[model samples]
Target: MLRVFRHYIPGITFVVIALDVSIVSATASLAGALGSWPGGGALWPKAACLVAVVLLCLYLADLYRLERHGRRELSARLLSALLSAAVITAAIGYAVPAFRFGRLAFGQTFLLLTVALGAWRSVWVTLDPGQRLRKRVLVLGVGPDAAQIVALRATGAQPYDVLGFLDDAPEAPERVPNGCELLGKSRDLLSLVDELRPDLVLVALADMRRSFP
Candidate 1:
């Protein structure tokens, strides 16, 4: 997780966005390489513009916040975003001749973006599951409250994962009813956060402390 302006954004969010940009650029580059196209490396700027527009459309469609939405909603919204991108891209190509990917090549780029991006996201969903949407959580203590928290983290119902617990003692209890690993000590919160990078750090101890990490 990365803290930006006091807000915690999932680390995977940046990774996926980077991948999306790369995917978009690659598709654009491939289309730019078509025999009928003129410039060789001059395609980068146009590709960058396309990438920006596509990302903007996806963001506006709420694709980045997938945890709160379902698969069906995902597909529908994506289709809407892509269609919007295509229309905007076509308009830009018309108004700016220099950035225009010839009609044939533009069609190819659009097709590739749709298929490649759709396939990549599907793979992300299968491989990474809720990493994009769910928060990677690190609980501060292994107490009754933590155990109840573990209970409440229902499968497929919540948007958080209890990455495990941190305790004041070095050793964990014999039976951690929370069913999560004892990662480290409470004093090691900062170090553990740097190591695990959980999106949220929850203090689950029954006791209250004046200073908590």
Candidate 2:
């Protein structure tokens, strides 16, 4: 359930915006019908602004979130938020004398917005599932730089397919043999490891390191 909610954030956001738009338009049209709205020309801009306000209000209230609340609790939160938004909308309509929107418009808009939002949430979840595979890789270097590459890969979500480490230095030899093979001389680098087909090739050598000798 937690995973499900995380995957549906985008859908929820889209729904919220759509709902706000529908509500504003309906409210403005109704106000116009009632002959209570401001000068005729200002209806659209005012409606647009009203939609913006509603969106802002939702944001402040944190209504359109996707946290993992239990089923019943989650439903309660949503219901409360919707009711709160409706009351706020009515208050705004009544207080601003210029904004004389109709109640019928508000009711219809709310229902339409509800249906649209729910449908969108369903569609978005179907399309985008979060889990994905990550390939593990082994770095074949024995220097400071090689260690850094290994570290960075570990932090990210994509799991690595690290086979092991391989040391190339000839003199000192490998100190901590981490199970990686010391595949032959560097000169045969291309031909020897062809089967590995690594997704990433990190050359972690200093200028002093000699070519395959």
Candidate 3:
């Protein structure tokens, strides 16, 4: 896990960053073409600059943070970042007339890039591979100890897909948290393992003296 802006992200940050940059660059190129820029030769430098500015703004806005945000809030932040990047790009163009894409071209590029980035982020959020790839965990008890595990799962920073708990004392009252299912008894471990195929099994036995097979 890597921490960014006080939020922890999985190891797939490199891949995600690369993909985002690629998409942004591609969008900038298309924007240039739409604006009738001289050619790829003249457009790439501008695209590179745009990519840097946009990415920097995103970083500053905590867009790279792993914490969940409502879709509306996220979209609003993304738009704000893009707008800030556009302002910076305009300032740079004003300072260096040679790099200017002209008012018309610059406007077109900003508009297109905004739409492109918005679409890319929407897809990224909707298809979060990290959530899909979270390790499936199975707890081996349903008592106070197991309840702690359930609470940890609900509040911990690390992402996990819990399959549920195994109740060793089948006849005892349910102690697991609400919404948490008692998958089965310890005797059914092998069959449950075959059925759920959990990535990790956590032993949370309430009784330390009890023998575990």
Per-prediction TM-score: 0.63, 0.40, 0.55
What would the per-residue lDDT of candidate 1 be over residues 150-188, giving only the tens digit for each residue? 777756575677877777643456535645667667787
Q: Please give the TM-score that candidate 3 achieves against the real structure.
A: 0.55
Task: For candidate 2, report its TM-score.
Answer: 0.40
Clashes of 3: 0
Q: Compare the candidates by lDDT and give the number of the best one.
A: 1
RMSD of each: 7.1, 15.4, 12.2
Predicted candidate 3 versus true structure: per-residue lDDT over 4-76, tens digit per residue: 5633344565665777698778766665567556232366677778778888998787677433444676798
Count of steric clashes across candidates, in order: 0, 9, 0
Q: lDDT per residue, candidate 2, 47-145, as tens digits?
A: 665576667655665555433233344345545655666777667667764543455545654555455544544444344323113453545555666
Q: Of the pair 2 and 3, which is ahead by TM-score? A: 3
- Model 1 lDDT on a 0 to 1 scale: 0.75
How much lDDT does each candidate structure score?
Answer: 0.75, 0.51, 0.69
